[model samples]
Target chain A: MNAGHRSESVPNASRLRIAVLAGGVGGAKFVRGLRQVAPEATISVITNTGDDLWLAGVRVCPDLDSIMYALAGVNDAERGWGRAGESERVSAELAAYGAGWPWFTLGDLDLGTHLARTSWLREGATLTEATARLAARWDLGVSLLPMSDDPVETHVVTEQGTMHFEEWWVRHRAALPALAFEQVGADRARPTPSVLGALASADAVLLAPSNPVVSIGTILGVPGLRDAVVSSSARIVGVSPIIGGAAVRGMAAQCLAAVDVDVSAAAVARHYGARVDGGLLDGWLVDTVDSAVVPELDSEGMRAVARPLYLSSLEQSAAIARDALAVALG
Target chain B: MNAGHRSESVPNASRLRIAVLAGGVGGAKFVRGLRQVAPEATISVITNTGDDLWLAGVRVCPDLDSIMYALAGVNDAERGWGRAGESERVSAELAAYGAGWPWFTLGDLDLGTHLARTSWLREGATLTEATARLAARWDLGVSLLPMSDDPVETHVVTEQGTMHFEEWWVRHRAALPALAFEQVGADRARPTPSVLGALASADAVLLAPSNPVVSIGTILGVPGLRDAVVSSSARIVGVSPIIGGAAVRGMAAQCLAAVDVDVSAAAVARHYGARVDGGLLDGWLVDTVDSAVVPELDSEGMRAVARPLYLSSLEQSAAIARDALAVALG
Candidate 1:
């Protein structure tokens, strides 16, 4: 798996054993591009379940669901999140009970996935099994996996009380000034067997355009995973979540600032820092808006490619993916 | 706390310290009636939670919710269950995932109660605390209490296998031939403190027309409670669940048969047996349909009176309560 470019294990190089780390909406959109470009690849999405929480007793895995909905072709295009043809009656009722967590509008249709996952988890099934079950239900061809089966919560430490990632993001609308980020229980949570296998056997690895601090950060925070990826020979490329100076979605800028990192694509690449300084990634995909940072990336001995990353449709996203992969392979 | 049929310690004979042991539909109906007739009475309903189950990770206490909705004046009278203005959108979603049992329709609004209860339970709150929280939300006047805070499931030994009560009632639609009934965990379950206090302090205790085998029997099966009721100084009156040869609601006749009892009002009284015989009841109210059973009840040294037992409406139910209370006082 350690070629520092693309491993030649993918079926015809047309079908790559591609593993992607992702969070919610932006990550999901990038994944949609990945799927469109590499339709024949055995894509394995390692979704961050750090955003997962028991909301009104249902296990709501926001990132996992977003990936699933996107891959299954059922994501709501207009709302930019959740399943298509969704209803929020359950959420409305939940709100009426003064459980007014307004930012995370749990669509009634989306609730089915949550209810199934929660039920199975309660029935002694691990989160891995629950994710598999949900994926099976969606019939999404690609393998979708949670980073771990164990409880690993992302908590944002703010001037206020250290709150859960969901509370920080959804309930508070990510309004609180984040001081730091901690993946609670991640020290004890090992990556699931499939996650390790997917990474090990991958032709290439892509980091979706998710928030670096709480999203992809939580995934990498899993003990031993960073070292495994650092040692792997596969090409590692990440699409920048930051465009110019602002985040594509969520509070990535705030997250970056909380971690004392500059809010720029170059800074994000530097924060990842070649995973032991040239040990994690061979390439980084930055948006056209960050074309100025490409020279700096090359100076750091990492290949940085500028792309028109404003994903307007599946076709545009596929074109971006093709160009990014071509640059990474070269 | 004892007087003739009223307790002097209760301080209000007109405003009775009325304690009721209840289950679902039938019990909830009787509670609605009690609410109407004795609006000023301190009504404490000790509801059976044995019928409670975790469906799709939501804690659904059928008996508790029935009593709650009935007391709140928002029960679906026609279906004899669930909230009056309920919607089954959530259930349809559950069905879509094939997660539902296909028997019970857990309406979205009704599901809010379950979700809240389950969430509370997951947070380490006892069933008693959760029940109090739910009741507080509905602003119910009557003090609704679960029979015990501990886990107690109503299990039915049927020809196929021992199934959960809901599985038996809903999945099979009571079509399976029940061979026996077991109050699982009843041996270890202790009555909630409020239940014991209500029994100890109550002037008159009413066993509403709920199924004796599963409903009232489950409460009686809880180790110390039946003995407490038997020994209490209060007048214990039981309204016949079996009006004639059939139950007014539910398959009470079927339940009685599972416990090897006949399907008559006389049979139901005999099942409660001479606690009525031993002067536990100063009064026994039978439906006019079973006026023939009154002679038998009178011969058993119990004061037997006939009244209309069909709870067709809240007003009619109040009339039944008035007559039953009058019989107890007589």
Candidate 2:
């Protein structure tokens, strides 16, 4: 075994309550792999609702469902969005009614999630409750959670105008250069008790290869969340969403620039420097191509491990996860 | 013109700014026919929001959308509920999660309306504003007004337990014999000013063939809406939802029974009654089968007009509307 490998055996499946901070696409892929490798782990995903917006009155939680669908084994692998057999007739009708923001194809089946969540939220339920109810519907083995019960919108302050994350990402195709990334209502949003409790009790915390700026960043933006994760006994590890230089999906590079972080694995590690520096990462996993950044990441106090984080196959992805756990318990 | 028809040189279109008090299904169909006959004339449908409920946090307005879809030319003709070309994948998923009542089949596209309305309400918009925004999206020319912006739910007190209108309508299929009908929050629900204005400014007023006890009756149940309609200068007319001894749609007869009204068109007329001992109905239209009850209605101080009120076709429905107008004007 490598020097980073630990002597402690992995936690039992039924007793393990692993919490993951996730975005979409990359995160969903990693989650699928995680579920395959650790089927018994009671996974709790604190998803980024920053990308969530009221599009024509439906509470569209893209990231949450991406993970939910991945867990439910119904996610669309081709588009990397929505369910595999999803229909868009409802979305087309929504477009016809001039509800706008048609770039995001809300499939008819996917719309069920939004409709249920929206309805629950309207009936005095928090976003947390709505999300839990939706997750329960899919019989999702792991608990799915919104980072905060309160509204915390991710505003991409572009040169053109301050627009919602969906407007910036989907509608505008993230074409406009972002001036800054603002997490609106972050100060007021409280970290869900479940998220905090999971952090406190977790033996290991995994940061899925979600967008560091908008996805994971938004979750950390919830006032007490970052602190809770940092102060926890759980060893923190993150898989770089950036494989080499470009993001797997979304404008992660642009988001990194807006947040004043360099678009490199080493910079991402340093950005999430140490669990002590308001950064929740202690172990950082980078792709083989970005192995050159190991020295810099180690210099910043994170145990840097170079592994194939491309997640091209479920086995490859699980191997990388095993590597992350190894480094965390070194 | 027939002897019952009040022949005049009055331009039908000019005198057709019809204000309709409605619930769902039957009410919507009459409004549909009304729109077909007088598309150019301003039609303002004041729907009963007393039947409105926040299920799973989505603000579902059965009457509002029923009328809106009917006017927008997309109501489901066969099922007599929701929009045409609708999908219930969302409802199915909700059921799978053990979430909201699933019997109603809230269509995916239709759920979008509720989502948007609920989201707007979350962002601090009243039901009126949300409904206006929703109608604007459909580009509906007819003014669709909620009886009250405040939350007013229609509750059916049955032997088993009191349940929401949607629960009673959808879950039980109105099977439970209702002990009484209660419009919850009606005492607190003051009618919107727009409703009174529409009623006063309307050239003619029509009550769609909705249930007198729970549909139109629910709207009239709002604190001041019934009083405004009763006192309005506009000529009032009502089409019978009940033809012979059976209702065109829904459990209108059962609802009438709950309110101690008989199941005949004449009974419907008497339910509206004479305003001060004989005043509420200026004119009442009954089907050919109920012609025997017309003399009884006239004796009770209600102007009764016998016509073929079974609205089987667009043209036939408009003919009934014309006859009702003729009687009201006489």
| Candidate number of the best DockQ | 1
lDDT of 2 by residue, B59-111 (tens): 78888988788767788877777888887777787777666766666787787
> Clashes in model 1: which pairs?
A1-A233, A1-A234, A2-A232, A2-A233, A3-A233, A4-A233, B274-B277
Steric collisions counted per model: 7, 16
Q: What TM-score should be assigned to candidate 1?
A: 0.93
- Report how far residue B195 has shifted in candidate 2, in Å: 2.4
Please write out the lDDT profile of model 2 over residues A9-54, one tens digit for every residue: 3456457667788887777778766665566677788788888887
Predictions' DockQ, in order: 0.51, 0.39
- lDDT (10s digit) by residue, model 1, range A1-330: 122224322226555688888888877787777666666778888889898887877888888888888878899989888888887777876666655355667787788788888888888999888888778767676788899898889999989889888888877878899998888899789998999999898878888788888888888889977766665667788888888877777799889999899998889988887743755567888888899999989888678998877767866676666665665555
The true-versus-predicted C-alpha distance at residue A13 of model 1, in Å, is 4.3
Which window of ten consecutive residues has the lowest lDDT sum in model 2 chain A?
Answer: A1-10
